[model samples]
Target: MRLSIFAAALAAFALTANTADAQTRVTYKSAKSGSSYYQMGVQIAEAMKAAGDISVTIEESQGSVQNVMEAAVRGGDYVFTAPPALVGAARAGKGPFEARPSPKFAEIRALFPIPSLTMHFVARADEGIESLADLEGKTILLGKGSFGADEGAKYMTLFGLDGKVTVADAELSNAVGALKNGQIDAFVTAGSFPAPNVIEAAAGTGVTVISLTDEQVAETGRARLVIPAGTYAGQDSDIVTTSLPVVAYTSTAMDDDTAYALTKTFWEQKAALGEAARWWNGVDAALLDNITGQIHPGALKYYDEAGIAVPDTAR
Candidate 1:
């Protein structure tokens, strides 16, 4: 009897040790080039580590679509992505996933909401193009492959801009260069408040950012977003334009207990998570309510504990 009791205690110790180590080994996958997005992931990882003995790692990922697939396949543990890409992946049933159609769609859940991305129409000071309609006959560089490009394409189709907006597809870096060289009348990109590229390009070039006006803002809200004053390139200045809201998405492959623990830790250490990245500014405990789609049980539990009401749809 004494020997059996000693053996049981030894096994329990090993199990406890394994559980503790599991929390320390949290890993995430994100894009290296997108500083803002990647920074958030790092912050989450750090917060997780600081909450316990967890060691967090962030690996370079392809893009939004790729990241989602990685998380679905368990190739990665966590991921951040825009809404459209996440939705598209959940429907396709492939990529970083094994599910044919709904693979991990229901399992993945929202972790955080990011600032809206402004889709700016940048024109040369002398171009005389006032509205998106004015670029009918002029050459325009719509951001390519990037989210901005994909959104722009959708906007053109939605607004019936087929013949009215003759846009040339080019990589963001190349497009910026082309715009500087007068190869394209305008360079467009969907980005966060104070887009680094636009600000950098406009520093000395005298570029102008156009707004969607009240009507346009409402119209674009159908597929994208538009932030109010003081959210753009200038501080203490009003910038009225349409944007695309970004959300941080994580995989559903995480076991319920692990996800629950991390979710609980995240809320408990919310301050640390926000301090980890610039994009997290203004994020409040309530903003978690703004999310669409399914909510992970762990997140739901955390929110419940905080007295935050979870929508029936999310459940």
Candidate 2:
């Protein structure tokens, strides 16, 4: 009788163990190091850890393309990417994901759009370089690798730069140093200012941060975003041009329940999240309605329970 009872208890334990194991583990990956996406992801992972019992993990990855592939293949459940990349993948099915046609877009959904990385180009004040047009035939430290190359391309398109613009493949720090050493004519970066790298670059390099004029800002805002002053560190006195917004995309594969829980948690602790990510300061709880994709039913339920107005689209 004792042996039979022991065997029955062991069987029950096995069933419970299997039941607990059934709860899926979700993992997220972000672009390489020194990126806000990676940092915010680390913070979110911490938040998930604090939430308890939910098995979630966040890892560093090779940037948007790799991330999207991982999500498409189910190698990862979520990824932090940019709107252009997501839309490009979904609309053209040309980049990042091809085996899956653009129609397979439903495989991924856009969770939310966050502000872009504030980008700028800095040249020594004494260099006689005043406008984007002056970058012609000048050596500029664009970015570390592909990221830097993209930054350079954006500016080139923005200013319609036609001169010889030399780009150096260097990290932010080295890029700044290159400017100071005359190895490069200027340094450009897209990040929060007093961004450690920019701050270091400014200390003695006499770097002058430049941006588009008010009219330019207005024009760009029509196509993109233009930030008000104080968005980055040096904007108040050091930067002469208006700021533009660079939106980042979040992983959309989170189930309705998990998405709801995460969204609810994000708003509930808005204060703390804002403190961690400066851009969150602009997020209004009401903007929940403005989410581009369908809000998870769980999130919608949470919004209703919270008494927040659900936008018509959401409804």
lDDT (tens digit, per residue) of candidate 1 on 198-304: 76656645566665666766776633343345543332434466655566666665555666676677667776654554445545454445567777676677777
Model 1 Cα shift for residue 88 (angstroms): 7.0
What digit string (tens of lDDT, one per residue) describes model 2 on residues 90-114?
Answer: 5466754666664434545444334
What is each predicted model's overall lDDT from 0 to 1? Answer: 0.64, 0.59
> 244, model 1: CA deviation in Å?
4.3
- Model 1, backbone clash pairs (residues 3+ apart or across chains), number: 5
Clashing pairs in 1: 24-54, 24-55, 69-96, 117-191, 225-243
Give the TM-score comparing model 1 with the true structure, all chains together: 0.70
Clashes of each: 5, 2
